[model samples]
Target: MREIVIGGAQMGPIQKADTREEVVDRMIALLQQAKGAGCDLVVFPELCLTTFFPRWYMEDQAEVDQWFEREMPNAATAPLFAAAREAQIAISFGYAELTPEGRHFNTSILTDRDGNIVGKYRKTHLPGHSEFDHDRAFQHLEKRYFEPGDTGFQVWRNMDAIMGMCICNDRRWPETYRVMGLQGVELVMLGYNTPSVNSQDSVEGLEKRLYHSELSMTSAAYQNATWVVGVAKAGDEDGHPLMGGSMIVDPNGYVMARAETEGDELIVHACDMDACSFGKSTIFDFARHRRIEHYGLICSQTGVVLPD
Candidate 1:
């Protein structure tokens, strides 16, 4: 039985005034807590280094690049890697990545116990508008600051488990998990910074958004027969309230642990790899029950035509 102790570290709001050193210290503090709890892995939320910068529309490229990290082990983040190495615990964290060619992507990196990078994933599903829209309560210009991830959904064998990653909106898409599920992923770690209010739909409230977050992750967990860890950067960020519903879901789609507050908190759970085998060998066994031949249209067509 490959049992892994997992820690979901949900962070509070990172105001614009917060410096990188301060944020890194907060992350290190969580790492220390996870270490104390005997956790084998810790997961932090997406774009954790700073306040959700996409909330503001910036015309200057230089101003936008300030939020992007040029290198992984730069001065500000070296402490995080050092702590993970010292504790011999694996870590998965998200950040804004600026490529050498000036391309920017919303990216996540997984590090082994020895502080070596195991794999990196760029966020494929980009949400929000690229241009400035005055109609919304706050601007969401992710489409303008970052490019759609070029890397397809990929899984890796790490920490004695088949792990996968996706960010934010990717959790809402079944295809994201299915692709990884097809590869025999046993656990998936993702991070999000979601606002409580929906700018696009006025009728949608915080309660509805929270419900959808839970529903999507739990459904994906059960359907894929994999454990899912979703960490959130919660609370109000620069006056915009973000939701704090970080949770860890088991293979049965049951939430094992969840954070109740919108702040820096850690929820640890021991996950048994054996739990996934039951579903994989039963109703969800793709090799035995799935009939791909009938679903060929999913790949053959981009859109479906409807009768008037």
Candidate 2:
């Protein structure tokens, strides 16, 4: 059946005062729990290692850089990798990456069962503004802190299936899934730290925000005929709240499992990769269904064009 038991580890929050060492300890505990639950793979939320730093505006470059990791599996995160290797489980998580060339990105990495990093995805669709927006209820300076990801959506062959990744705001964009879907992806993993309330719309509450998150993932899963796992770093981070609707969806767009709380929770499900075949071969067969010639405008333009 090519079945894989996956675990979505939804973390509550990581306050600014939290250390990487402390965060890794929390992650290891989740990994241990996943192992006990017989999970072959575990997925953690975007910026899993620290508080969503983009929510704050920092003027000092050194202070900003402190939130970024110059290297993966560095001193602070080595133990988490070791624990995953010891448990023989695959894992995926997101963090702020600082390149040697002085570039920064919101990045995620995928590891194999033996704990070898096989794939890395930098978040392409960054949300929020770069400058201080007096209009916003709170700051979300992602554009100020990170460069838009250069790596296009790409898939890898792992766990005996074609897998792909995106992060946070990328999930809301259809192109993110379509690109990976075109490559015959069978599984997609993504993570987010979305606010419980929309910054721009004060009327939009937690329930509506969660609904949109699930709708995006579920619709994408069905359209692409792939299994999708979305994990969230939820609950109050300091005083700001992040919503939690972490879930695992089947190829048919069914919610196989979901987290019950906005805490450090693990939702597990046994998914058959082969289940993707029926839809892919039928309705979603790109080769048979897509008319690329009529879709040029998708790549040709960024904004809406009015009729002449």
- The C-alpha RMSD in Å for every predicted model, in order, reads 1.1, 0.6
Error at 267, model 1, angstroms: 0.6
Pull out the clashing pairs in model 2: none
- Model 2 error, position 123 (Å): 0.4
Residues 236-271, candidate 2: write the lDDT tens digits: 999999999999999889999999999999999998
Q: Model 1: per-residue lDDT, tens digit, 1-308?
A: 99999999999999999999999999999999999999999999999999999998899999999999999979999999999999999999999999999899999999888999998999998999999998998888999999999888899999889999999999999989999999999999999999989988879998899999999999999999999999999999889999999999999999999999999999999999889999999999999998998988777886777779
lDDT of 2 at 233: 99
The total of clashing pairs for model 2 equals 0
- lDDT score at residue 18, model 1, on the 0-100 scale: 97
In model 2, what lDDT does residue 121 have? 97
lDDT of 1 at 202: 76
lDDT of model 1, residue 277: 97
